[model samples]
Target: MSSIIVTNIAPTITEQQISEFFSFCGKISTISLDHNTAAADKSLVAKITFAKKEAAETALLLHDTKLGPTSVVVEADPTAPAPAATADDAADGELRQEDKPRSAIMAEILSYGYALSDKATQKSVEFDQKNGVSTKFHSFLKDVDDKLKVRERASATDEKYNVTGHLHDTKSTLSRYFEKALDNSTGSKIRAFYADSSKHANDVHKEARRLADMRTGKSPADTPEPELASSAPVSV
Candidate 1:
């Protein structure tokens, strides 16, 4: 009945690992790892629902605990009610507030691309200041630069297509554009950015549709899977 939000989970961590880590506190009913929430950040956000409220409170003590090399942020999940729809949303026939116009969505996506690029750059600078730009910092800088490059491409693509206003319902066209943009890049990091961005967009579309379905009473709410029975430590 109680849920906790776990943020800054290392990309190397898996659902099984998270389940086992939290199982030590008490019975875990479900664990939902939402990588799509902030794909560009190279982090995972998980919603851990405990069978008992006390268990959730217990798990909160793990806040700032090291999940991998980096510490994680854990807090009680704020189950805020969905926002009320405006007259414009009603006129647009959008059942949920998240179902915005295609151009609006693209604009938001572009903003996220820029924000993530800036975040990576800032982190790299901070790391260099702290570590004096060691070999590890060089590698980190390279990774951040690669991510920024891909995000720039994604932002450009989104802006171009947003002007054209033709990407609303055409997944194939979007895929083709992404492919053409990434054709010259052979690095794994670049490929990962492309994949993650595409997946994130698709997930947003799917969730919007799901919310519409729920509003019409056509589909039931998504249920989280039961926790797996595993106590083994998560492999990095």
Candidate 2:
């Protein structure tokens, strides 16, 4: 199925940032940009639709890089109906909210919109560029260095732990697997790999879950799957 998303873009990023990032990944169908001028500061919100899910996923990961803050990729939830407006709301009788200060605008431009993030998932995408997950994973690798320092301090011989080795191995394996998954001529294999990997264990499972959450702006728990029914007719 094709994927569509509406992003609450970071203010600092421009339309070029979004286009360039997706162009690097693959072909795109459309990008609709809406600018809000009534506010004190200018902001751009865009809806991006991709012909392929892989392209969307790849493009979404770019959110944390140069395109971060002003760029986010939100999944279009088909099941949830639009909130209904009451009669008073439709008549514009609701109280007007206070405006945000310039400081708030600057902060929003700099921040990666983690507050809008899903707390349960703990994944965040950048707004300026298309390469945030790799950057985030690299940042996470710093923890391994801390672990190694702790291990060396505890050891009498000052021997570092295998944290770095493990990280390198994990990164290498994931790179190879990801290339294989995307090597299909017609994109079918890539989708199949994504589907099958969801149900089983492999090195990519944990990282895929992490990246998926970061890219999609949705929690890992929200991933869709075909639920097994309890009552089923079994015919011989």
Candidate 3:
């Protein structure tokens, strides 16, 4: 009951800014941002859980007003696990309508388009351990456009984000691990992970490059995805 949802946030807004903005409500237990990459605007949404119930109440008071730069809508999280709910409440089917369940990568994608934090890097490893991650990344790339195309016209596009930089950095990090040992030959799980991760990296980078071209008036064909500082050929 101490959670609230903040919507229509800018992608560039950081967790620190979100925390500071909501500090008036008291200690915050967690802050998570959600992004819709397929959305033309690519605005972010955040779910914050306050340590104290009253704190969330205090923040919800500012709902509908632009109390912070990134937040446009602040509302109660009716779906938060209630401390105690009567069996009658359950029988009545009093619940939030979850039109879409969140995916494991929901919190991960927003980490890109910016510098890689330790948390983001760690999350990458966590994703590797989770099942169906490669498929999810593939789907993400498809939404991003498999060819890594940037469909957003220059006029309709907002300010350019350094998506290429982040992807490049992430791939470089992956390459190092992929090349960590010469013994990691074909059929190695690590090798497969690297191959899949690198492919997605390339997919994301292609879109980033195209977006860059659109913004700078460069011909899409004239530019290539930025080369990673370190890269390795995958056997898998």
Candidate 4:
């Protein structure tokens, strides 16, 4: 679970040179040439997953000793066992506070399973061919869609039933507006589209009531009104 990820590697370092550098360690997982053939402007990126952290550290130390200009960083999987604590370290109450269970950490990071799924959805929507919808981004988009649906439903219920509830729906709506605007590589046009669509949906609901009133010969003013906007923001 210990991997050596070499980035900003000097152009002079060839694939064979990198392979030889880590020859003392375990097998390499992947080595990729992420740069073009501009000698002074080339950078090689390689990922080497070792059988053990010590072996990986040995490779890093070797790089530090011989390859002075290159920069390499090691990232170990969170689920992997932490580096062995020394005897003096044992004197400390806890070896590490960040070593929470991987599942629990992932749960907190994802917050909701659908949120991660929504990221995948966004990727999909970005790469779609037929409709040019990116299927890779679809998971993320779907998760967001699910969350909005739930919030919208809750808002409608709370407003119609005269019930009190936290401002989650309003906050979620605004959060999505900002998040979409910020992350979309294209621009804020998509955010504007969503905002307009939301307003349109609410308008459609009102229009339906208008039609019903006309058919029943009732006054349009008889329809119940929407609630006022909330004043404060909410957090995830």
Candidate 5:
């Protein structure tokens, strides 16, 4: 028996409907539908084993053919393991600092800066929560300084790389706005601002990492960021 895999099955499709549709081509020995339970975003896949290899070939020829409202992609089932990476692949993977694309490197640097800012904000929250009113002011000031340092580094890197003018202006404007807000904020407002900023910074970092990983072929295009460590309450 030979197998043909069909993908892009609509959610409304059923095993019986798939079986009936393929039965017109040839006798189906078995049918297996992979319902992705891990995530709701993924599409379903169906593996149809045909009694004759000729039937499987016939199905393969139906690639990109419509199977309802969507165009279904059909291909022969993989019978062998993927080939191991060769030396050339390894050589290409070891990218030097100068060899890396300027845009990618700039993105990576910006991500690092965002990560630093997030870390500072997180620490500020923890410090405020741990120490009473006596130390909260000091901690807030320290956090502001740390965040400004990160922003300064990112701006300098962007200037060195001659990044787009709009990006530079946007970053500078946001940084100044955030600084002014932090200076005026106190007590709960400070914490709230830091929390919101941290969340946004982490999101940007995650997107940068996702894009970098995709370019390097280290992960699938749809892969999510690895689980982050749980935030724990700090005690002084």
Candidate 6:
């Protein structure tokens, strides 16, 4: 098989984000993202066709792995017509890892896009920079920033206080404009992101502090004001 089927996809999952996760395995020929993912109670699917059979085998390796916080099923594409369901097969039913101990409702898909993420996954996925639909966080933020102008406002606010304040790292800058992109951000997603101190953990932590330092690092206000020269002659 040169293709794989991913099921139980959160509607929020985009084609690009999924590609980022799997592209490291091999060259992908095509990725078909579900357009009707918004339908409730329906689990979406994504079909990935890789250039070679080896890629499909490697992708099937993630069959039981977590996609974000939830477990999704990945399997090699059977490529044949659906089999007629027997009583036993129907009784068994399709089981997904996320279905176990299922919650009262499906959890909100907050896996946020994969771009600008300090995660090691970014080191692998190649993204198209031209499209607003680009998987890179910059593109993601750029689209969001258009209406809210959050980055514009944040940049203005920063310059208003300290004219020279700037973050050289573009990704971190975009992260700042997005405002919620820092390490101190708390939530279930962030907590999982910080799981067990690994190299990725250290990298995110260190990068967060680095981004924080842009403002907290130095202050124009800290410099002493130059003494004012009086136009009036000094008293003899």
Give the top-scoring candidate (lDDT). Answer: 5
> Which stretches of model 6 miss by more than 4 angstroms?
35-40, 80-236
lDDT of each: 0.44, 0.35, 0.42, 0.36, 0.45, 0.40
TM agreement with the true structure for every prediction? 0.33, 0.29, 0.33, 0.26, 0.32, 0.33
Off by over 4 Å in 5: 37-40, 80-236
lDDT of 6 by residue, 1-236 (tens): 27788887776677887886666444577888774365464656888987655445446645545566555678877882332332321123222121111010001111112222222222211111111121233233444446444344454435422112322212333333334322223322332322212223232333333233334433222322223121111110
lDDT at position 190, candidate 4:
37
The C-alpha stretches of model 1 lying farther than 4 A from their native spots are 80-236
Count the clashes in each prediction: 0, 21, 0, 26, 0, 1
Q: Is candidate 2 or 3 superior in TM-score?
A: 3
Candidate 6 local Cα displacement, residue 130, angstroms: 43
Q: Candidate 2: misplaced stretches above 4 Å?
A: 1-3, 37-40, 57-73, 77-236
Report the candidate with higher lDDT, 1 versus 4: 1
User: How well is each residue in 147-219 modelled by candidate 2, as lDDT tens digits?
Assistant: 4345533342232112221112243333323333233242233234322222222212233333333233432
Across 88-134, the per-residue lDDT of candidate 4 in tens digits comes to 22133221112211111112222211122222222222222113212
Q: What TM-score does prediction 3 earn?
A: 0.33
Model 6 Cα RMSD, 1 decimal: 21.1
**Which RMSD does model 1 reach against the true structure?**
21.8
Q: Model 5 shows how many backbone clashes?
A: 0
List model 1 lDDT by residue over 1-236, tens digit each: 67899999888999997886665444677898877465576899999887655456556655665665656787899992232432332243212212212212322222222111222223322332343422322343355446555665555434432213322233333343333334333234223432222223323323233223323333222312113122111111
What is the alpha-carbon RMSD of candidate 3 to the true structure?
A: 16.6
Candidate 3 lDDT, tens digit per residue, 156-198?
Answer: 2332222333222233322222232112232143234333433
Q: Candidate 2 overall Cα lDDT vs. reference?
A: 0.35
By TM-score, is 1 or 5 better? 1
